[model samples]
Target: MTVSRRAGLLSAFLLPSVLTATTATGAALAQEGKPREVVSTISSGYFDDYLMLAVDGKAKTLSGYYNDGKCRFIFRDALSPTELYQRSELGEAYVVDSWDPDHPDRHFTTTLYSKTPNGYRNQLTLEPGSRDENRPKACRNRISLDRSSWVSESFYDVAVVRKRGARVFTIARAGEKPTPAPRKDRLPPPGTGVWIDRTYSAAFSPKGFVRLNWYDPPGTPHGGYVRQEDLYPSQPLPQRDGGDEAVQ
Candidate 1:
């Protein structure tokens, strides 16, 4: 998108009613206390000017909402209602580049803390670009999907194993049988590869499967899963100064 066009779009999005709560009461209502139970309902949107990852009809993850009213919350795993609030805090400090607003496809670099044998620790990711500038798109293909579509431009770099050993991996979609080695040229091809040095979020398995939502290469950005042994414990990344990687 052009600079001027991008600015106009951002201006429209930044308007109080669209991006945040204009009045204290609106903010207060949006920031209302968490729901009392795990009701299985999950929602996404602005609550009191803060973007939130809502659960059980309540706002669990909170932050400044942006990106054309669509904030993508990567589901790391299922947690108690209380633990959800604690993890959502990671999005509070997300600082995007001034020019990032131009590219609607980009997502903020989040600070992920994954569980490991030693305990929880921070992981690193590429810092988000400016909100006002054009940056390289995370999803190479520009195919547009609905806000609720499975396709995503960003990903959560989680691990299923640690550095203690190595294993071959066959990246497969959820419910699909694992193929030996699909092809290296494709995105997340089913292949046998060793763990790379990096840090990601904790493993979350619901329904007895390790799940993730991301942009499926050569197609839409959506959610998929792999075997538990496929992931690894990653090294931590240095924290950035400011950014709000909010949940949807």
Candidate 2:
């Protein structure tokens, strides 16, 4: 999409109704209060925003979601109503509910916890068949026959695996971006975008995973929505002063 066209789309998305949550009451309601484990009900709000992963050698994918609010969660092979939740401070965060928004039959459970100066721990117990060694993986293609559509354009990187005979074809993004045309283009070539390293494994199966993550910025591209400066004058996207890669 052209720069001007991309801007218009973003502007429409950033409409007042689509604004991010910030109310103290609502946030606190969604906050992790102590630790609890039991059959629970979740809101579609949890899995709303996410990152995608594809396993080139397998028949699954790893899907992740984050709350613009203290939590980010990822789910492997949508196995059951049981889900796993992870939390981090200082960035967009929120809890992820496992129930499907469109289909009420599917669900998952997760234990909530807090990591302070003391140590890391889980506050809840396993639900029925939940595995002891908690990790990440994509769901069986059963739930989302169209995993491609379930994810956003920026999340195309999640589909690393293609069915040997059951091919899950994706709308390969636009061709290689020779360059960031005019800074207002609507999309990035499938290969270009913010990338992170991750290993996704399927549930109840032998542990199998590979590291590499790919992602693109949301919306058409950088141009009609005004700069982040104009919208949130109170806070700005952080500027990293310095950083270094650590040995794994």
Which model scores highest in lDDT? 1
Off by over 4 Å in 1: 1-38, 43-78, 82-179, 188-213, 216-248
Cα deviation of 107, candidate 1, in Å:
22
lDDT of 1 at 153: 16
lDDT values, one for every candidate? 0.30, 0.26
Tell me how candidate 2 scores on lDDT.
0.26
The reply for model 2, stretches above 4 Å from the true place, is 1-47, 50-58, 77-217, 220-248
Q: Please give the TM-score that candidate 1 achieves against the real structure.
A: 0.21
Q: RMSDs, each prediction?
A: 21.6, 26.2
